[model samples]
Target: MSLAPSSAPARMPGWLLILPALLFLVAFFVLPLIDNSLRSFEVGGEFSLGRYIQLLTDTFYLGVIVETVVLSTAVTVICALIGYPVAYYLVRHAGRWSGLIVFLLIAPLLTSIIMRTYGWQVLFARRGLVNTLLVQDLGILERPLQLLNTPGIAIAALVHVLVPFMVLSIATVLQGIDQRLEEGAQMLGASRWRTFLEVTLPLSADGIGTGAILVFMIANGSFVTLVLLGGGFQTLPLFIYQQFTTTRDFGMASTMSTILLVIAMTCLYLQLRLVRRAGV
Candidate 1:
């Protein structure tokens, strides 16, 4: 053998390897957040809590906050309730109809949100299919009911858009669960419902928590859907937009943005804690 020393490739440190991503995060996300936080606190070249104080003290802003919370919670709950059964069916019966179901679930996401919302606009019109069916075909109503621009319609649109996320999340977790655990529970004289309650539900907590946090975060930040569906009913994001664009109040906009960020982070933290406590 030649007397050449064996050459080994040097391994990079983990931190060095991740430096680009860390730098990107700092440049884009972290720096923007810091800037916004500082801007929110800035008032007339001096630091103040006046923007936040106004947000908390004003009834209009408070109402928007409450509305945002309620809408987000309602959408999350509805998605969870509806998505579980669909996810379970997909996991348990993977061969038949699963592909079609998945296709339908993902099809809407591929389209533009504006186009989808406009489709809803068409359906919700006075002479739309819903009204046509109810009034002419079904004869359930003598006159077309005002269906558009209502809180109910807004919630429904949000649920339709977001439910797929919840379904996929839960289904992914459920697919990894061993079938023996569920069957064993059933064999122990437990009814199907009881077995599911005791065995299947507990293991799916992680997925549920993940989906809930995601849906809640997205719902709170909803702009286009709420504007198109709510029909003048304003939420926090709308409020922030108005502050920034219409009122040109940068301080208030930044403050509201920061508050929204806090709310999202707090909700995520609490959900993680709950999921951990549930042993998921």
Candidate 2:
């Protein structure tokens, strides 16, 4: 026999509160994704495998996808390399100076991304401020560096944009760590270096992995940074934009976007696996 209505556990309003969010997600994200996916499989507005076949056979599209993934990976690695120490210092060393350091970490993130990209534009351009400083003031070089329009500069700019995300993800994990653990390690004849390697790094692996995934995803999906710095290097984002807007082929763009979605989902899955294994 079914239980009476009143015998059922009273449900919390947390779900009720989230109903609007759920609705919005369905309306926006779910619908758009479904439509895009449908479009990716279509030819002339009907179901077909032509789009997928075309994408697979197209060498240019493949190159664009590879370039985007590689650039994003580079950005993620750079952000992790630089962001870890900054996060570590904020979590471990800074006490009264924590507020100041945190602000310094957050200031760039707070600025508009467009503004940041423009800053890079000015810095990296031939005869720009960086070139002038390097050649005239620092005497590091006799000529202005051609830094404005290369894959390396694009990656560098993207890294600058992405580093803070890595730092924030790492900072959260660092904050959660017990300070006494390090003290205990010190008492047990472990030097600071050994303690960090043995205790801190292992424990902070989840955060590092999370940050890497976040940065990598952002870098992979980037359009503005690549367009401005790449100067027509043709990443997936720029390619999609051109496909839809210039070439006026929404189908190809959607196919490319689907490929990107696949890549993002794979990265996310791997990140979750890593985090789970690390016991995060």
Candidate 3:
């Protein structure tokens, strides 16, 4: 006797599976952004571009924009310079210690940002370890130097915080590269430097691009680190904070937020293009 064919369970639609996530984003992310964008244009309950005009035209505001871009660029460059070597070592030679290297790289990220920033403050304070070491131990300075709340210190702190991102990005790309390729290059009489310059570097460009985009986007929106360590440096975030809290100009604050969002979106677009070009 032949048995009746068993019925199969119906499969759910892919969109249905993600409907909750979509609704959550709409409620939390999309709605807030739309509200902010609308507020930027609203002046006394009417649409106006006065806020944008002022932000774009005023030299002080313009300077803050330029300074924000410049600071992000500097941080990106410095992170790249510091991260590449550590990534190279991690990927090429870490061996059994790779886990330890990765742990160290990620440990700082697990700490609270406020705590990390305060740690920097302590190290750079007037009677801090750095001042003590330079003046008393090393005799490098006649007295404690003013190290805290400066642009250089801010940049250094940012680099210290962001370099791990760069290293991890580059390390991920490096792991995908074939060892045979490097060995072949060496066998063809290429020196280690030449092999790296021509082969490894070119292949790892996508990682550098990805890391640069990440670092730049983050540095653009950085508030706490800059606020504590920047010595009154004016960037868009700080300016936006001042506009909201001090000047009580919500419209201007919203406009600055919109501008910062645009900048971040542009960097994200570049990152996507880079990923696509790399076939990743």
In terms of lDDT, which candidate is strongest? 3
Q: For residues 94-199, could you state the per-residue lDDT of candidate 1 as single tens digits? A: 6788999999889988988788788888998899999999999999999998988987887888888889999998888898789899999988899999999989
Instruction: Write one digit per residue (lDDT tens) for candidate 2, span 1-280.
Output: 2243345446543346568999999999989998898888988767999878877778877788777887777788889999999999888789899999878878988888789889988887898898999999999998998888877777777888889899999999999989899899999999989999999998888889899999988887888777666655777888887887779888889988888989889989998887787676
lDDT of 3 by residue, 109-158 (tens): 99988898899989999999999999999999999989997888888888
lDDT of 1: 0.86
lDDT of 2 at 194: 99
Model 2 residue 199 CA deviation (Å) reads: 2.1
Candidate lDDT (C-alpha), each = 0.86, 0.84, 0.89
Cα TM-score per model: 0.88, 0.85, 0.93
**Candidate 3 Cα errors over 4 Å, as ranges:** 1-14
> Would you give me the overall lDDT of model 2?
0.84
State the TM-score for model 2: 0.85
Where does the lowest 10-residue lDDT sum fall in candidate 3? 1-10
What TM-score does structure 1 among the candidates reach?
A: 0.88
Error of 2 at 18 (Å): 4.0
